[model samples]
Target: MQFFASLVRSVYAATILATTGYAPSFSGDTKHNAVGAAKAIESFHPESSFETFDVNGIDHPLSDRPEFSLEDAAVSFVQSRLNITSDAVAFRTGYANDVIQHAYIHQQINGITVANAVANVAFNKKNRVVSFGSSFVQPSSVPSNTPSISVTDAIAKAESQLAGEYNGHPTTLEFVAKEDGSVALAHVVQIQDDDQDMWVEAFVDAHTGDIVHLTDFGAHASASPVYRALPLREQNVTQGFRTIKNPQNKAASPIGWHNNGVTKTNNTSGNNVITYVRGKGGARYTTPQSSAPLIFNYMQDPTKNPNATRANVHAARVNAFYVVNTMHDIFYLYGFTERASNFQNTNFGKGGWGNDRVEVSVQDTRGKNNAFFYTPPDGQHGYMKVYLFNRSVPMRDGALENDLVVHETTHGITNRMTGGGTARCLQTLESKGLGEGWSDAVAEWTEWTNATITDWVFCPYLKRGGFRIYPYSTNSTTDPLKYSSLKTLTEEHRIGAVWGNILHNVYAALVSKHGFSATAKTDPKTKGGNTVFLHLLIDALALQPCNPTFPQARAAWIQADANRYGGANKCTLWKAFASRGLGIGAANRVDSKKVPAGC
Candidate 1:
């Protein structure tokens, strides 16, 4: 979700497809009505900005707090903001400390759920609306429920768009809302062509039998061992093998890594992930490792011939298993939990869905120079393929590079969290670029051994420089990616470098003030700039709007800080972002190198 490649290249594709094919970002007649909240909001905080897409609350209590509950307030706010009058309802509530922190609502008209019409409202400890994102398109009118075409015809209409047969799945009737303010009653048909590795949701027009819209949900990793999984310092900066047993984090993998509770699995298969290898021979289900650990320490004297290490095939799988499971554990501690729709086969009866553990293919012979991750919705399996590179031994296995693993794995995180677990956001060119950037930033965030954060390139061992066009650095010359660079760069990863580098500076800015936390992973409350940045980063993913532009993302980070730390880091964040041209005035993918006064 690698050849379809960039989880997008299969992060930017070689041929950047026009993401305009997806539904346009939502806007409605309610834009004028939302300004009332803005005026109230500005009374408390002077710098707040409101749009049809997202609203950030000021630092003070919301004036329109509902008498009943946060859900009631959410419904009311969404109704006022999005102009959705027909039975606005809160379907999900996100809890933090025995209190509702956020409410998720869907727009329903005439008893039918408006496709992709959703909004999220967040509350602080004081039950105040801190921020919210809306893609809810409240139409001027609703179409008839009756379908002019049969379901069979709708399916055929969907299938006719491509050459492959429809992957066997059920079709449902729903309304497909467009940006032009027209709503079409359609059959949402899901088609998966395994051969093409293509899976998409096709909105077949029920009235006209024409395809109204299509969303490719497959939006589209590791290890260590003294038996030797590598570190974030890259493959060459090997920390060597360190023996570890039961490495799975207790809270993240409560049921252990190997067993899914329903069936006994001794192999690398587990509740969070399942690792396997596919040979070039095209054999099906040909390789899944056994539980028995092996000494994959064979380097085959890489100086002599790196490809000779191919004798130890299982070593890559072992490293991959370690890294994948470790990332699952580390990020879970940050915020990606079972309730947040994280990848896990079992949720221990917790919130969110299950049976969606990551499906990882190590050293997959599919492509070179890249690894990819394709994330479906919360309940479906995520697919990751790490291919082999030809340069530098350059017949290098991508699984050995921890950077690649982390980068690919994070695609799942950004995808699920961005659009409230829909995995349908981040499909636009800029959003997809953000997706690539977030993945790279997360990789850079985790792989640190000291407080002195260094400027580093990605997968330098495989590629001469890095998989990206530039090293994520604070140096303007080496990584001189400003917000303005985004306008010139159309490819996702290149565009990602700009965003990622900006975050790189942001991380540096935060770390300089609060210092670094060595125990970041083990301690949730580790109060350091690096740790704080991670909180802001992940939280911002949920805070941002669907198909977010650079400015929207920057605002989300500020709002996330407001919700998390009561705006303590607002000045620090503004300064960091401003230094990189994502200051108070950045918008529409333009670079603005200016911060607010007093920052």
Candidate 2:
């Protein structure tokens, strides 16, 4: 069977690559030696070697001189002083106030860029280099450029190794450098595995017909049977049986339900998500399945029946699955491709690479009323745990709260998209705060799009008066928090509140100018100010640098708008940012609590 499969793949690859002229290189595994790179930088500047520096695993400090030119001097130092032979090409460079100038440089060998190898350098205002780092592949010896096997044969080998269905063709051909500095001429193929819900990049050795590297871009993930339920927001006064859309159904007419799945053990039929009920002891156990789809009946009165409480919990789980899947589809319409980090088990191979799924755990703790999202590194799946209602506190089940779920899920999205889909990149104090702000902003947008809530309040049940420090509104006076507020705030969530306020203002301004469209809510293709906001936000994530600060993030957003709309929304965006103290002149260091003053 294996031999037959290999033969079939070879035939298919041959047929596909016959018409293509040349293939571009794809990213492969590259081991970054930060310590070694730091040592190299230290060797050049012995005076600064003895001074202790705070290096973020990825960067090493050099000196604190304020007059250094990052573009000219730093690049020159890396090429002249370092042992790397590849030509360094500057791709990104920026400065923050009088603090530091940072640059990102890519290495190229034989006219082909080395995948995942980069040199990052930062210079202080005193003209001295303060930080330097590299994830560069310094090969000991150059290999023959000519390949022994054809590109088609390499693709065939890669196809034969795939465990699931995939689509798309080879995107590039280049020499891939391994962790040990060994290089090989390889065909880089882009594929989507729908069965596992992943976008994949497979690098096949052209000479050996072996898949030298496989990058799972990440598979980017539900339920029902009868269970009681509440309104999307548990605190809503309106109550009774309500029909909710079932996201799992592929057909035009999806399942409409009132109760959560009762008979489904794993909710496997939905295929988008798998919900597990781990009761008080954190042990997986079975819950009663209902035959009727009337799960909302359980939420009418919480004290009615023990079974009713279970049914209510189940209903929330079902709703969470639906909301998250809907969020996935909505973002997909706006360009969150399988390669961009979505939640699904299968794309079959049309979109990007899979295996990045969102795992939801309902009733996580015995009586803890809280919810959180955990994003693992790229290629790894993320899990969200929505704890049960606190028995002693005024809080209700977090799973029942759509806003909370959306907020947490947004965390996963931001973490995955920022810093090129790596969790290790967004670690600075400002970045952490930005992550929280993004979650809040996205959650608010989701609510507005659905027309489920008029005002943005994180959790109403948790705080009867509303949970957020300030409700998201069009009125600036309602939430006076601004970028300058970061100067006094140290906590991430608090700092995030300021950011959320700014976004809310932007959302309001756009709505006022473009007019909120109901059509956009249901149609992903429809363009509205709301859609524009989301598009720019997501695009900015791709453009943002690692460990970005407020100014850097603002620049990314502006760049995203330029890339997408040709700077159509520049005035409005600038005004919105300026209102929040993150205007053109806003500049602050990554570690500083002081906020940048707007122009």
Candidate 3:
């Protein structure tokens, strides 16, 4: 079956040989597995668009500076890589075909050998070629005798395991098989119920026709978690007990509280504004003590609360609320709560935490001190801003409310996972979103490893009303002022949502294939949370090229999946990500071994 990308090996010659351990054996009589032999031949075929300049013994020279423009360069590269001749006579008109199974035999002007090649070309609305499928091997490796599962069979099995029985729901099931004995099955299930639309995917063993894996992502499976109510004071007391920090006080105190050097409260009030600050002085240079926990200080407009006051007790009460949000709602926050006090006049930028303690700012923009500090000079100090775009007198509007707060905190947890060094903004953003999505997915998953959210309370932030949010809607396009001008909205959040959608689908696939235990493959830590999401994201990142695009992104993930987890694992996840226009596995055709290390 034709996949989503063209079959071309574009890599530096030296890198490819070294990475793939290519000895270039000229074993003429060597017999190989039918599938393996097909793969090897496809990997070796050279394109034919460029002029073949004979050098010493190497027939074609690998030039970093080729004599062609980028567009022509691409054509030349593909022709050379696929060994396609420019002459129409070489490309037999009689053999011209569309799917990957049809092979086109072509010969070059030089003495280069001609071979059969499959052409699966995709065209856009303008009829311009968008992508190509892999070259098909002559005498196709697909067994002529064995019966393969049809798209219908694959969909039925998936629907039974995933979709269940939905009344009058129009859906389409599509399947694609590759020479590697893996099949990708996709299902688009429309909804008549109140829930949003859902897309399901399943990977099947090409030979055995057994369902290998699956994923389901739709309005039903995409609901956020229900946050349990914990009083700020009680949350503080619970945290204090955990860290044994100032137990006499019901809430956990800020860092350095026992030393008395820690500033307990620093509250400043102006005409209509009251500022509460916490964690003014802590050992910014020394290693954190085992007992002292990382506390997340939250900045909120206290005017909304009925008992608004300038008392230290009010400051302390808000401190407990931050702790409660971290420990209960966000599970990644297992660290101790060192302290929670008020800042006098310092700006903490919206609200952020450093080391293990949270910070609150008195200034509007957090005094620039709480901004996104790039690799700081001192190894021990650094921070990122959580700017509140809009706010009401009583509450922070457009603020990263409970869900957004958890999402940012997840970034903190991930930073620790990769060590404290600076990470790519893309990496941080992608991983941050994944972490957020994971929290959301887990919340939804817990509700019913299978049921859709039935109440408005489950998805409070879906939209202006209690209605479900369109998981696939392009919302960033509508809100221009909300994001940065550096990149398009699609680049930032939409791209993010695409990644998020993939994760949701993949999680569903894993559950369908192996239940909850399959999550262990990626999350060996078994932290009651899925760490596989992290590994998959990391592996994909490692394989990604320096400058990546949608197509390359898809290819990178596939290459990583094939290399790290065996191509057979998470087949459904692969198919699902591909189907969403995120780019298919075939687009990521580079041999990752050649990729530079320590990215």
Top lDDT model: 1
How would you order the candidates by TM-score, starting with the best? 1, 2, 3
Candidate 3 has an lDDT of 0.31
Candidate 1 lDDT, 524-571, residue by residue in tens: 689988899899998998889999999999999999999999998989
Candidate 3 deviates by what RMSD?
29.2
Better of 1 and 2 by TM-score: 1
Better of 1 and 3 by TM-score: 1
| Candidate 2: 10-residue stretch with minimal lDDT | 40-49
The 0-to-1 C-alpha lDDT of every candidate, in the order given, reads: 0.69, 0.58, 0.31
Order of candidate numbers by lDDT, starting with the best: 1, 2, 3
Q: Please, what are the lDDT tens digits per residue for candidate 2 over residues 1-599? A: 01111223355433322221111321232332111111100000001111213433222223343444556665664553343332444444555565666677765567665554566666555555566655554354446667788766665665556543336653676665554446666777765544334456766676787665656565321234333343333333223435543433232112222112212223412323445566566654433334433232334334442224656555556656656666665666666666776555444354533555677777675446577788886556678887865543333656666778778888877887786566776687888899888888887776564322245777775555555688776566777777778888888888888778878877776666566656553465456778788888888987898878887888898899899989877777887777777776676522222223331
RMSD per prediction, one decimal?
Answer: 23.3, 24.9, 29.2
Candidates 1 and 3, the one with greater lDDT: 1
lDDT of 2: 0.58
Model 1: residues >4 Å from true position, as ranges?
A: 1-227, 232-239, 279-311
